[model samples]
Target: MNMCFVTHKVRKGDGQGRVNYEVILEALRQGHYVYIIASELSDELAQHERVIWKKIAVEGWPTELLRNQIFAIRASLWLTILRNRIDLTIVNGFTAYVRSDINCIHFVHSAWLRSKYHPIVERKSLSSFYQYIYTRLNRSLERMAMKRTRTIVAVSEQVKHELKGDAHIEGNRIAVIRNGVDLEEFYPRHVDRRELHLSEQQLYAMFAGDLRSSRKNLDTVLKALVSVPEIHLLVLGNTKGSLYPQMAADLGLGERVQFLGYRTDMATWMSAADLFVFPSRYEPFALVLLEAMAVGLPVVASSNCGAVELLTNKAAIIINDPDDSDALADALLRCAADRRQLKQMGEEARRLACQHSWSAMAAQYLQLIQETALHKAVPLPES
Candidate 1:
């Protein structure tokens, strides 16, 4: 089968990009001719013999919204022209356009618009105003594109629900395919706290992701840390110009919180920690949570996170309210109070993470693509 994939980026590091990258590799391994329409392509993917890279040069844009719009328009036009040659077309929601068979939506823009903690809702800056307008425009485009899509691949059941409820997409047309983590790259390892310059006796909780975003709900973690003095929080991800450092100081959590900034050795950091905390207000699917679980780290996360649905039993302590610092504090304290239970939960988390591998995820996507390609009928609208 000759497959065409349209995405903004075809590289690692990014969530959707990494997923696409894995799928493309799987498609190639399955002896499929894969064509990628992307703004940026990684060296490894670019050099693949079975892959065809159609790079769309996106530049000279003042804002990311404009750059993405330009790339999508260009890619859409190219897809239409090459529609005759391509057997099937799979597109990311961000770049969904004409001649798409399957639309794989990583994050529902409509869901973010409804989130009270989203930057567009919380921030009052000019940049936030631009983000507000951009989000609205993206939502409108996505809804229209989804209507025309033959099959919709949602990263989570939460996203599938939003697609049906908010975007008016039919439930039958959407398939829930949760995001996966590279188990080989993120499995548990023996890491000494002394190597990371931390006392072995001190309890450490790791929190990763863009701390600048209020949606991540890092402030709640900071507030919670104040109550759990024994548990020190190791902050990861980009910290440049973020107010989290200041917020920690203001909350009198200067000693309890340590901002490690963005580090490539996330597996090491995750393994070194006693637990992982991610109380995000809105998360379609957090790969970091899966990565943490892969490294045998018990998680204290919000029920709002889509990945939380995958965890069962005592694998994780899920909080009802992402903004409730007291609840988060209590969960952390409970985990710290019981070492044996915490260790058992970590083992359970690792077992769960191992079940959701990238290879398995790629196989599921391939099967979906094959099934969608066989059925040519247009999806019915929800009544």
Candidate 2:
């Protein structure tokens, strides 16, 4: 099969982009001619023998009008390419590009452009006029894409519910294929916490990913740290943003919080931690949680996290309210006090992690593609 993937752009250290890269490579390994249509393509991805990287301009435009103009032109070009060479087109996030023989699978990451999530994002980022235009326009385009797609893949059931009203997609049409962990890379390893410059006695809590994104709400994590006197947070990833060293000082967390930016060995960091805390406001799939679990670390996560649904009774502690610092602190303290229980829970978490592999996720995608192709044989009635 000739498979085509459409995403924003290919860049280094991007989670979704890297996932797409892996999946594309897997499809290529299966002898599929995988082509990518992106806003920009990195040299690393372009160098792949079986992968074709096509660039189009839909990004870095100053205004929504300008962005849409580029989108229209790019969509036309993308559709032209799809008509000739592509047997099946997998539109990653931006699915409103074109019509194809297969209905594009709208793989939603988060339930964006809705009441709760949209208002929070819009208030934080866009101006009033842009918010109004963006809300209406993107919602319309998403609905159109959802209607036209061959299938919809929700990263989690939480996301499926979040997108249900917004996308108006049929339950059967939307399959839940989660983001998985590379167990080979994420499993328990012998990496010293002291090597990362931490004391052996000090209890470490970890928060990974971009500190800038409000949806992550690292502020809550910082505030929670104040309540737990003995526990220190080792923030793994970039911290040059609103919710980093500045937020730590603002909240008076001070030296208790340490921001370790972009470490090469996340598994090492996960191994170093007593607890993994993810207080994300919204997530389609908390891939980081799986990584943490793979390294035998107990997780203290927000209920809004999509991956929490995958948790076993022994492994994870889910705090429903993101604003509840006390809840987060309490969970952290519980794990800190009980070494035997914590180690047992960690073992159970690792057991769960072993069940989910990238190979399984890739296989699910292959099955979905084959099923969609088979379904395409049947004729559909016009709306």
Candidate 3:
């Protein structure tokens, strides 16, 4: 069988790219001839046996929207030139202009575009307008692309619903395939807080994301943490061009929060922490939540996160609203005051994270694509 994957990137570092990377590896492992049409691919994978990479480099483009458009054109040309050689074509949502067998959706632009917290809705600037156009254009293109594809694979139930309700695709059309974490890389390892910190007595909660945007909801976290003096927050993100550090100081949470800008050692920090707090206003599926859980750290996240659906029982604490600082404060205080319950929840989180390893997720994708090959998939609209 010849399998072709169409996406922008195929590397371990990126989120959506990692999914394609694992799946493609699985396809190769199964002895299938895999063709990757991507702008950027890991060198080792591209050099592997029976794997062909059609590099469609468009990184120099000024904006993401333009780059994607150029990539689609280049990828579409490649597909047309080698259509017969490919047995099945799997594409990420709106990646290429041509219709393919399976469409894997990472994020639903239509849903985010309509979100009250979207940049277009909350902000009024040229940059915000550009984002609106980018999202708006992608949303329209994705609808057409998803419609033409034989199958749709959503990264989460949250995205699945977005396709069904927002994109007007039927519920039966989308298959939920949550992203996987590298259990080996994320597993609990002892990290002595004394090595990086000034305090051994203070319980710490870690949050990681872009600090520049309120979309990640760091502002609300600062607001919530101002009251919880018992628990200190260590934020892992780039502080450059971000007001969060300043915001933390002004809010009188200077002692309560420590901003550790972006670093390669996330697993170490996560392992050292007592809790992982991510209350993003909108998250399709936060791999950080899963990664934190993988390291035996209890999670407190918002219900708006799609990944929250994967968690069951006491592994996570779900806050209904990200803006509710009182609730966030309470959740943090509860974990800070009770060591036994926190440990129990962290252990439970590890137990759940163990189930969603990268190998397991890749195997599921392999089996599904194999099944899809045997039977001709009917497009949801026509079916």
Candidate 4:
């Protein structure tokens, strides 16, 4: 099969990029000719013998929205030219333009707009105004792409629901496939506190993601920290210009909240922590939650997290309200107070993580691609 994957990037760092990278590798492993249409490609992927890299140069754009639009236009033109040659085309949700066999949706824009901390509703800056316009534009494009796509692959059930309920996509057209974790890279481990520069006696709670966005709800984590005095937060993401440091100081959590910044050694960081805390207002799927669980860490996450669907009460504590600092704090406090229960939950979490692997996810995608190719084509809506 000649498989074509269109995405903004093909790399290991970002979530969507990593997913594209993994699936491509899997396709090649199965003896398929894989063509990657991307703006950025990792050195390793570029060097692969079986992989064909079609680079689209859209850099130096003034804004992310412009860059994305240009990339989509370029990709759509290329797809149109190769429509008859390629067996299947898989497009990333945000930038989809051309008629493709499968549209892989990582995040639903309509769902984000309805989130409690959506920038369109909460922010008042000029940048926020531009972001609102960009989101609206993307939403319009997404609807058009969905109408033309033969099949839709949603990253989570929550996203599938959003597609059907918010975007008016047919249920039969959408398939729910959850993201997978790299089990070998993120398995249960023990690390020394001194190596990570942490106190051996203090309990560490970890949160990993972009801190600048209110959607991550780090402020809620900070407030929750104020109530739970014993647990220190190990923040593993970029925080150079974020207001979280100032917010932490204002809450008198200056010493308790440690900003580690972005680190490639996330597995070690997870190993250093006692538990994982994700208080996101909205997440299509939190990959870090799976990684944390893979490293044998119990999670206290918000109900809005799509990954929470894979968890049970024995493996995690789910907070009904992401905005409620009291609920988050109480959940953390409960875990902190009970060592045996926390350990048991961590064990259960590790067990669950072991069940999900990147290879398994790729196989599922492969099977779907084959099945979609065999099914009769549905007429695309008129452009």
TM-score for each of the candidates: 0.97, 0.88, 0.97, 0.97
lDDT of 4 by residue, 1-383 (tens): 89899999988878899888888888888899878889999888899887888889987898888899889888878877777678888888856576788999998887666665778788688978897888787888888888878899999899999999989999999998888999989988778889778899888899999988888889999998898997999998899889999999999998989999999999998999999999789999999999999999999999999999889999999998998999999999999998889999999999998878988898888889889878736566675
Better of 2 and 4 by TM-score: 4
Q: Which lDDT tens digits does candidate 2 get at residues 178-217? A: 7768888888777666677888878788899777666687
- Per model, how many backbone clashes are there? 0, 1, 0, 0
Scored against the true structure, residue 235 in model 4 reaches a CA lDDT of 94
* Predicted candidate 1 versus true structure: per-residue lDDT over 108-202, tens digit per residue: 88878887876767868997888888888899988877876789999989888888888888898899988889988899888988988988888
Name the weakest run of 10 consecutive residues (lDDT summed) in model 4.
374-383
Q: How much lDDT does candidate 4 score? A: 0.88
- How would you order the candidates by TM-score, starting with the best? 4, 3, 1, 2
Worst 10 residues of 1 by lDDT: 374-383
As for candidate 1, its clashing pairs are: none
Residue 359 error for model 2, in Å?
1.3
* Candidate 4 TM-score over all chains jointly: 0.97
User: lDDT per residue, candidate 3, 1-383, as tens digits?
Assistant: 99899999999878899999999998888899999999899987989989999999896799899999999999999999999899899999998888788899988999999999899888799989999999999999999898888879998989998899899987876888899999989998887788997477778999999888788999888888887888889999999999998899999988888899997899998988899999999999988899999999999999988889878758888899998999998988888888899999999999998989999999989888987888764443452
Q: After aligning candidate 1 to the native by TM-score, how far in Å is the CA of 197 from where it should be?
A: 0.8
